[model samples]
Structures are given as C-alpha cells and as structure tokens.
Target: MRQGLILVVFAALLPVVAASFLQGQSALEDARKLAFERMIGTASAVAERQRDPFVIGQHLLLVHATNPDVTDMTDTCDAALRASLSSYPPITNIARTAADGTVRCSAIAFAGNINLAQEGWWQRGVSAKGMTITKAPIYGRIAKRDVLFLILPLRSGDGRQNGTLTAAIDVNYLRRALHDAGARNAGTLAIVTRDGKVVTDSNNALAFKPAMGAEPDQPIEARDKDGTMWIYTLHKIYSSDLFVVYAEPRAQLMATAVAQMRAGMLLPLISILLASIAIWVGTNRLALTWLRELQNMSARFAKGDFKGDQARFERAPEEIAAFSADLHIMADVIDRRNTDLTQALEAKSQLTREVHHRVKNNLQIINSLLTLQSGRVREGAAKEVLAQTRARISALALIHRLLYEQDNGYDRGEVAIDNLMAELCLQLRSARRSMFQVELTCHARNFPVPVDYAVPLTLFVVEAVTNAFRHAFPAGTRGAVHLNLDLQAGDAILEISDNGIGYSVTDEAGQMGTELMRGFATQVEGNLSIISSEGAGTQVILKFPLPNMSITNAPPLGSVPAF
Candidate 1:
C-alpha cells in the first residue's frame, strides 16, 4: 500500500520536472542564435576578399588576335590563360578556348605549351548567353590538388563573345577561411552545391562524404546531448547556390532548466509523502475490520449456514479495492454452487434407483427363456442341452446382479472363475453323469471383464464344456476333460482340452462345435487355437481378451465359469 502511494505521488510530480527542463532549453536556443550570428559574420568577411568578378573579366578581355605585340591567340591564347592562373598560390593550372571551339593546356606556371579542344569548362561558358561564367571541379596531376577551374567569357563592349579565360582555385584556401569562422566542433561543416555536392569543408576529414538523403537541407532545429535546444544557421553564396554552415552548442544553458525542474518537484513530492502516510493509517484500520468479518463468516458456514454472506461492512482502501471485489465475487459464486449441489444429489439418487429396476426386469426375461426351453425338451439329449442352456442363463444373470450391487456398475467387480466353474460342472454332472471327469484349474487372481465382454465369454465356456462331454468320451472309452482359465499379460486365455480324436482344419466334415467355437472367439475380440493329434488330447484355447481397462478384486465362490 505504501509503495503504491509513493508511485502515484511520483507520477504527479514528473510533469512539473519535464516543463522546467524545457524552459532552460528555450534560453539555450536564444544563446545559440547569438553565437551563430557572429560566426556567419566572420564567414562573410572571408568570402568578400575572394570575390572579384570584374577583375577576372578584365584579365580575360585583354587578349586579341590582331594585337601583334602579344602572341597570336590562334591556339596558344588558351594555354596562356592556364599558365597565368597557375602563377597565383590559390590556383594550380588553367585552360582556355575561344568561343569558336579551340582549346589548350600547359604544365609550366605560364609557359609550357600544349593544345586540346572541346574542353568541358570552355564549352559551359561559350554555350551560355552573354559573358557567361562556369566552375568545374577537377583533379590536376601536375598540381596534385583538388581544384575548381573557373571559366569567364571575355566579350566586346556590345556583349559579343571574343574568347574565354579560365583560372584554377585551390580548395585548401577555402577550408582555411571556414576555419576562422568557428568551424572547430564535433559535427562537420561543409560548403555544398544546392544539389548536395560537397565543394569544401573546414576539416576535410571526410573529403567527399555524401551529404544527401533524409537529413535537414536548410537550418536544423534539434536538442543537444544535455537536452539543451539550439538551431543551425546556413548561408548561401550569391552566384551558384553554394552554401556554408555555423553551429552553436548549448548544453550549459539547459542546466538552468534542470534546476527549475528539481525545484518544481520538491513541493509535490513532500505533499504526496504526507498524503501516503495518512492513507497507510486508514488502510491498516480497514484491513483489520475485514479480517474479523471473514472469521465470523467462515464459522457460520462450518455450522452448515452456507447462505450466510461472507464479508460485510466493507471499507476497503484503493490499495485493496481489487482484492475486496474479488472476495465479494467469490462469495456470490459459492452461494450459487451450494444450490447446484442440492439438485445434483437428488438427481444421483433417482439414477441409482432406475438402474436397479432395469436390472431386475432383464433377469426375469432370462429366467422366462430358460423355463420355456426346459419345458419343450423330450429326448435325454435334448433335456441335457436345455439344462446346460439354463446354466448359461444363470451365468449371465449373476453378471447383472453384480453390476447393480456395485457403486459404478459398468467398471467394478470381477467374476470369480473358481466358483462359476464349480457351479457349471455340478449342473453338467447332474444332467448327465458320464464316465468323463472335468478338471478346471486357474493360476491368476479373479479380475473383472465388463458385462458386455463377459456375457459372450460365459456362454462360450458352457458350449465348449458341453461339447467335450457329449462327443469326446466315446462308448466304452475313458478320458479326462481339462479346462484351464488364466489371466496373463493383456489377455485371459481359456484352454479347454479333451482326450478326443482330432481333425484337420480343412476337414470340417462333422466339426460344427469347432467352427462355432472359432466364431465365438472372434465375436469377443479374441483368437482361438485348436491342437489335436490322434493319440494326444485335443486342446482348444480361446484367448478372450479380458477388459484390459477394468478389474475388481473379489473372492471366488467354488470353481465355476464366471461371467
């Protein structure tokens, strides 16, 4: 709660701090403007000294083809221009050509003669109207310098083109000029064409760094490292849209703004701290009241008063408002849950009663079928079959009885194999006491098979035992009937063996019982194997896959075929 109060107070004070700092930035801007103005003035002075359009024009106008005292300008006049311009420290080499399409170049300061034609700077000036001017950036081999070749057209007083004169200007001299104009700063400054081509820079560190694309073209307004605001001032040279820059750094000025911000936050922080203390005290009182109410409400619920409200007289501070709302919602939810529980209990009771009634009805139907079949029997063999059928029905009836007695009928209880087998044998022995004796053995404990699977399995066992008795022991012959039931791994294997004469799989001539056994095994999702030799016993093993999913531990009642 105290932490929350502190955060709220801090949020309210943060804006005052931001605005105070912004004020210092405003002052810094004014100072930067003043600083750049002085730098620009200095830059302008250096530019004026280098400006000489007329002097350049006159130097070009002095040459004429008819003035014999001077050399014929037929070819060498252009060479003379280059030589003359090279004499100045600021120039390296120059070239010239008449407007009539002739050109020359030279290696000496004013004497080494060479001739060339159709020069770029000469063409630029001649193609221009009147006494046109042009400047070309070039890298000169002899001068070993980056220089600008300036071409000026010499014209008659009436503006007729006589010829063109050219001069080369040293770039280093321009950098020196910008140096005095306070160009020593972290960021670079350069003179550039309006097209973003760099002509010169104060430091010349990145001699030809590309200055175009997504940066400010004119003066730039931005904040500095210390959040001190300032502006950049730019100047354009008159003739060619060439530009220069002056920057004013302003970090020191923003400290004033930082001071104002600290001052503004002081009052709000103190007030918030005081407010937090008061809220802390109020929340402490309200929390104790809520805890006591919770204790009383839980006690009432323990006494079975589920309808009692959980928390009342609610007085929650903002810090605990969310927790209080969640508690109230929880109580409303619990009240709804109790009502649902009562309805669910009554529904469960009705379902159990319905299941019991259905089971009784089903058992009656099985008994009726058994009674009707027993009444229709005439011959001894027929009566014996009827009695066996009755025993099979009883096995099925017992499964239903077990299901209805258990809590969750479908999933619980196993048929006791020993007891089920004992009863089946007795029923068989009573119907017909042949010389054949039936021996049943089980190795595993009793386990459940779901009613659906166990019903078919029970009937299958009865049919196998009856078949062995009726057919395996012939007249004046004696043999034993061995039936073994086992639960192993994933399947319950039922092996019924008889010392009867065996037959081949292909010889189904009179083997109705064998075929039927195969069908029954398949019906219960199991496999049947018949092993028989003339001298050895015939063993029929039906691997009835017990419900791998379900089992119940219950004591076996005598050895019997369990459902």
Candidate 2:
C-alpha cells in the first residue's frame, strides 16, 4: 500500500517536473538568441557611423570637380576636404589627385607636387576608376597613421577620368568604435575588410589578422581555441567594403539564462514537492484507511459472517458506503430466505410421514379383508387363490409400513431391501402357514429402493415364497426357505429357494401362481425364472436394474415382455 501510494504520487509529479524543466530550457535558449541579435545590432550601428564620413566627402568632391568654370579648383576642393575632415572624427586625410598621380588638392598644404599614382592604394583605385575602399588599413605616408582610404574617380564631361578624390580614415577611430561596442556586451567586436583581413578589432593582436573561418556578411556560431562557444554576427556597411562582426561568449549568455531559470523554477518545484507529499498523506489518512477496513469486512463476509452495524458502513468513505449498504441488504435477504426454507422443509416432512402412515393403514385393511374372504371359502383352488392374493396384498402393505418405519431423514420414503425382505418373510409366514411353521431366512445386502419399485418387487418376492411354501413341500414338511436380495452393479437380484420336494417339469397345476409371479416381475421391470424338477428343491430368481431414488414411477408393464 505504501509503495502504491508513492508510485501514484510520483506518477502525477513526473509531468509537472518535466514541463517545468522544458520551460526553463526554452526560456534559456530564447535569452541566448536575443543576446546574440543585440550584439550584432550594436556592431552594425558603429559600422554605419564609420561609413558616414566617406559618403559626405564623396559628395563634396564630386560637386566641386564638376564645375567647368572654376578658376581656383584646388582651393575650392581643398576647402571642402578640410571641412569634411573636421566634421567627421574617423576621416584623417583627404586629397584630390590627377590621373597622372600629381596631387591637385590636399588637406595638408605642401610646397611642391607629390606623385602618388604608383602607390598600392592609388594603383588599385586607378584600376577600379570608381570609388574604392581598401581591404585593410595601411600606414599612409601622407597622413602618418594607420588608415583606410575611400577613392572616388572624378570624370570629365566626356566621361573620362580627370582626377581622383581620396579620403583617408583614422584606424584608431575605427578601433575605438569596435572596442566601445564590444565593451557594452562584455565580448569582442571587429570590423573586417572584404578580403578577410581584420581592419579594426577590440583585441590588438587580432587587428590586421585573418578572421577565423568567418564568412562575410553572415551570422555564424563557432568555438574559439579555448573551447568557449562564440556567436559571430556580421553586418556589411552600406557605403564601404567592410564587415562589422560582433562575437559574444556563450558562457555569459548561459550564466544569465541560468540565473533566470533558477528564479523561475524555484517556487514551482517546491510547490510540486509539497503537493505530492500532501496528496500521499491525505489519501492514506482519508481514503486508504477506509478502503482497508472495507477489504477486511469483505473477507469476513466470505466466511459467512454478515453481521455488521449500520453505523459502521455509514461511517465509511462515501465512495464505497453504498456498496456496503447493498451487501448488508443482500445478507439479510439470504438469512431470511434460509429460515423460510428450513420451516418449509420441516412441514413437508411431517406431511410425508402422515401420508405414509395413512397409506400403510389403508393397505392393511385391504389385506385383512382379503384374509377374511379367503377363510369364508372352502379348501379348494378358489381358497388357495384367495390365500395367494392375500399374501401379495400383504407384501404391498408391508412396504408402506417399512417406509413409515424409516426414521432416518435421508431414507424417509425409501425401503432398505434387506431389512424389508427379512420382515416381509416373517409376515408372509405368519399370514400363510399358521398350521406348519417353515424355517425362513433372508440373505440380502443393504440397498434402498423407492416405494414405487419396492411395492411391485415386494409382491413378486411374496408370490415366489408363497408358491414354494405351498407346493415345494408336502404335509408334515419342515424345510428351510432362503430369501436373498442383493445389489450388483446398479441392479437388484431377489432369489427365493427351498429344500423341498419339487414338481415335474411338465406339471401345469401351479400355472396360475407362475403366471401371477411373472406378472409381478413385469410390473417391476424384472426377469423371473423358476428352477424346479421332480424330487428337487425349487429356486425362484428375479433380477432387475435399479434406477436412482428420484425415479418413483415404474415403466410400462408391456415394455418388459415375459420370458
């Protein structure tokens, strides 16, 4: 029970814990992604500021070089460049040079002409014949600082290059922008030229070095040498060939997320634990205790103890209280029905006893009337036939008397064949041979027959014994008559034999008695055969199948043909 309660509580808690855990993980991932985007946006804003000066200087130089009637072109262009340099902090130097690399205008006033057409930045600008941003910051001989140049070609009215406008950007200013933008995020930021060279970066060593596996103008996630996760987000500046890259440490993102998740999950986890404990304790006290008591009551009911007070079930939990009430009602119904059946069975028994007594008395009166009738007749065949009829009538009366005598409850309407035959032989001898006493003994086994079969079988036995007493012996004859009834393999066998002078095989004088015995055998569904010869004792045997005691009615007499 304790284990079951624990399992149920854990089952309910598992989903809540899992959902909270998943929610924490989702919040952490969202925060990390948001931080990644913020760093990228910061670097992009700085890159835009750095590109503003080149855009302004290009406009100024193009407007001045386009005027065909300007006599002081150098002074006009030089004044425009000086004004642009002062206004923008990232612009360090601006110059206008002819296609032959002779300086036409300069922010610095030089005494003589300086040729710069063969310089690396100048040669690349000449080949492009348009605005060109340098791949990496270079040490400028004219400006005397690490700088990048934006050169725009000045086209004549005929669309041929006349001179070039060169704007030099201060690398320190670019570096400072990268540093300040990255400092806000507590990570590294860099601006790289299109050819993978770092133009400016927060880290000094990383400046002018190749970017590590970075694609231009794309967001990427990678790891550094020390195995810290870094997200590198890139934004291309619009007016120049530069990429602004922002990298934030994954560990810092995770630290912030972890703190958030800890704050978010504390109360829910504690509440789940407390709720699980409370449910476990509450159910054990309020529900499980009542259920256990009800289980014990059911066990007692199985053993036939249905007695319980109504207050006991009323005090049970509401879930099973109605079930308890129904069980109590069912037990009461069974007890009342049991009492009713017992009284009915006792009344039925008394009625059966009275019926048996009345039947035995009525049959005895018939037997007595037959005996009186036999005495009124003379000593002839008529009188002999009356004596046989009286004997058969007395056999049926004795069966009812035996059934009445049965006091055992199991054998109430049954006759024990052995005891029935013994008492029957004594009664038959007294009814028939009052003049000479015949030694009669019954050898039989204990088997019960219902009253229906017993009546016909008893009469059959009486006919056989009476015939043997009358014809098997002569005057002054003293002989033994053995009556046997035994059970063998679901069959009953009755045998009556005498040690007396027997009749001839062809004698027809006792045909009536023989036919009468055969008729009684047919009525009981039995086989009767007589064994007699001159000067030999007679044996009458009857064998019949015994059915269950519930089969009270005999089969049709025609069904058992006499053989």
Candidate 3:
C-alpha cells in the first residue's frame, strides 16, 4: 500500500516533469534566437563603423586629386599635401606618381629608390577610369608603415590615363577604429580580406577569420585554429574583398540560454521532490504506522502472546482502527481456546496416569499371586512354569509403573527404553540363583517407545534374558549376559547374548520361551534371530522399526560390542 501511494504521487508528477523539460527546451531556443539577432545587429553596426574611416579617406583623396596645385605639381603642391596629411590622422602620406614612375609631389619623402611604374596598384589605377582601393594592405615604401592606398587616375582631355594621385591609409589607424567600435559590443570584431587574410582585429590572439561560403547577415559557428568555438556573422565593409566579422565564444553565447533552461526546470524538480517527500511522510503517518503495529501484534498473537496494548490503534484511521479491533478479538478467541485445550490436556494426562497406576497395581497383585502359588507347587517343572509366568507379569508391571511415574509433559504415554532395559536387567539378575554366578550387563540408547510397542518390546527382552539365565548355564557355572539396545538408520536393534552352554536352534524350535519371544517380536513388528551353538554363547537379536520419537542420550552408531 505504501508503494502504491508513492507510485500515485509519481504518476501525478510525471506530466509536470515532462512539461518542465519541454518548457526548458523552448526557453533555451528562444534565448538562442534572441542572442543571434543581437549578434547579427552588432556585426552590421561594427561593419558600418569600420567602413567610416575608409569612406572619409576616399573622399579626401578624391577632393585633393581635383585640386589644381596637386594635379599640376606646382611648388605649393607638396605643402598642400602635407597640410592634408596633418589634418587627417588616418592618412599616412599623399603622393603623385607620373605615368613613367616618377614621384612628383609628396607629403612624405620617398624611402629608397622607389618607383610606382611596376607596382600592381599603380598599374591598375593608371588604366582605370575611376578611383580604386587596394584589395589588401601593403608596406608603404615612402611612409615606412603598413598601409592601403586609394588611387585616382589622372586623365587627359580625351579620357586617357596620364598619372595617378594616391593617398596611403594607415593600417594601424584602421585597427584603432575597429577597436573603438568593438568596445561597445560584447564579442570580438575583425576585418578580413576576400582571400581570408586578417587586416585588423580587436583581439589579435583570436584567429577571427570569415567562414567559407558565409553569407552576409547570417550567423554561423566555426572553430578557430586554436580549436576555440565561436558563433560569428559576416558583413561586407564597402567592398567585396573586405568584410567585418563579429564573433563571441560559443560558451558565452549560450550561457544565457543555459541559465534560462536551468531556471525553467528548477521549480518543477523541487516540486516533485517535495511532493514525494510529503507523500512518503503522510503515508507513513496515516496508514503505514498503524499497519506496522498491527503486523507486530499479529506476530505476537501467532506466538500465543496476546498481551499487546490495544489502545495504540485508537488514533488510527477508521478502517485501520476497525481492523485492529477485529484482530484483537480474534487473538482473544484464540487465547481462550488455547486455555481450554490446555486444561483438557491436563485432565486427560491425569486420567491416563491414574489408569496406568491402577493397571500396575493389578499386575503387581497377579505377580504376588503367582509367587505364592509357585511356593506351594510340588512338581519342579510346574514351579518353573509358575516362576516364568511371575517374571513375565513383573515385566508388565514395570512398564505400567514407568508410565504412571512419567511427569514430563512430552510423550507421557511412552516409556524410555534405556531405563526400562536397565531396570529389567536388574530384576533378571536378582531373580537368578546365587550359585549361578551370572554377570548381567545392559547397555541401551536413550529413546522412548509408545506403550503399545513398549509392552511387547519389554516382554521380548525379559523372555530372552530369562531363557539365558534358566537354560544356558549349568549348576555352579559362572557366565555373563549382555543386553544392548541401539538405533541405526531408522531401525531399533535389541541384542541379548550369554556366555553359557549353547543350545541348537533345531532342538529349541518349539520351546515355550523361544515361541514366546518370537510372538513378542511379532507383536512389535520386529525380526528375531536366535544364534546358539554347542560350547559357544547364545545370542538373541531383535530388529524393529523405531517409533517416531526424539532420542536423548543416544549412543553413537557401532557402539555395541561384538560378543
């Protein structure tokens, strides 16, 4: 029942847990979308800002190219160019190169023996109809710094190219502009050429290059050369060859989404845990506690102990209280029944003991009558018969005496075979003539047999021992008799042997004592064997199935010695 309650709680909470998981997933996706939009917007804004300096430099160069002093290379042309360079910090130098590669007007003096005739930018600018910018930055020979040149073609009246007016934009100045733009953003920023060369970056340690086949305004994830993951988007900065890349670390980009997911799930998980704990405690208090008390009471009742406090269940739920009441009533009924059975058993045992006492008295009276009759008999054979009958009667009376004397509660109707045999051997020894000098010894294992089998068993032992005392030894002969009772496997074995003048079984086949022993053996459902040979001891063996009774002080197997 407790398990069922817990399962019910889980069943109710399962939907909440599933909904929480789905809600967390939705929250994470929404956070990702919002983060992507912000990243794209930042990339676009930074791209525009980065393009500003290049646009201003281009316009300045275009205005200066149309100036008469600069176009005619007059004496004031170098002074005008130097004044323009001082006004704009982004421009490193301004110069005019003739079609044949001669430096005519300059803002900064040329370094080395430099000529622009073979330069790729100058060659492309001379034949171009309008201004052109270099695809990548180059080291300026005149300014002695990395720069990108904006070149304007000097044309004749017929539109043929004559010379070029050029202004070098400092790469470091553009890098500074990009850094300022990046300061307001949360991610790194970089400008890269179409060929994947980095022109400037807010952070140089990060290889913030554009991804292959990346579309403008679309975000993509890529790993840098150092294996750091980044989420970045690209934007074109005024030209096809140059692009601005805005990127953030993937972990940083997803941090908000992860936090939102965790928050979304936390409440439901806590709710389930708290609910389960409540159910566990509530069930134990309302039902399980009383059930446990009832279970303990039932166990006590099974052990015949009905003394548990019935008031313990008074505060329980109605059904449990009713159950406890019924259980207590049943225990009372069983207790009363047990008391009645105990009283009846005591009365029956008392009656059985009384009956055995009366039977023992009657047998003792018969033995006494036989003893007195044997004294008056004249014939020796008749007296012998009377004595034997008296001995048999004595054995029966001994059995009855043992039954009447039994005080232990267990198996009062049974006689301890060991005690019976020991006393029987004593009686046999006492009855023998003193001149015979027969040493009688009895060794028996301690197990009880019911009175029905005990009667025949005792009679069998008495008759066998008496025959050995009466006929096995001659007058004035010294001999010994041994009686043994043993249990082997599930069979009881009783053996009586005597060292006396042995008799032939063929001659004693119809003897009264032998016939009586055989009849007694049959009564106890046993097999009897008489082993006798002239000049050898006589042995009588009786094997029977042991009664179903516990044995005490039983000797180990094979303890009986060979005669």
TM-score against truth, every candidate = 0.36, 0.49, 0.80
User: Candidate 2, residues 41-98: lDDT per residue as tens digits?
Assistant: 7767776766666576566556645544221354476666566566666677777788
Task: Report the C-alpha lDDT of model 3 over 111-227, residue by residue, as the tens digit.
Answer: 555678988878887787777778788998888899988888887677766698888888998788778877777788888877777877885444546674678888798888888
Clashes of each: 14, 0, 0
Best model number under TM-score: 3
lDDT of 1 at 113: 40
Off by over 4 Å in 1: 1-379, 407-436, 443-448, 473-494, 497-510, 544-563
The local distance difference test score of each candidate is 0.56, 0.71, 0.81
Residue 500, model 3: Cα distance from true site in angstroms? 2.3
Give the least accurate 10-residue stretch of model 1, judged by summed lDDT: 63-72
What's model 3's overall lDDT? Answer: 0.81
**Relative to the unseen true structure, what is the C-alpha lDDT of residue 30 in candidate 2, on a scale of 0 to 100?**
92
Candidate 2, residue 113: the lDDT equals 67
Candidate 2 runs further than 4 Å off: 1-47, 56-89, 95-121, 139-146, 154-165, 183-236, 243-304, 309-311, 318-330, 343-563
- When sorted by lDDT, best at the front, the candidate numbers are 3, 2, 1
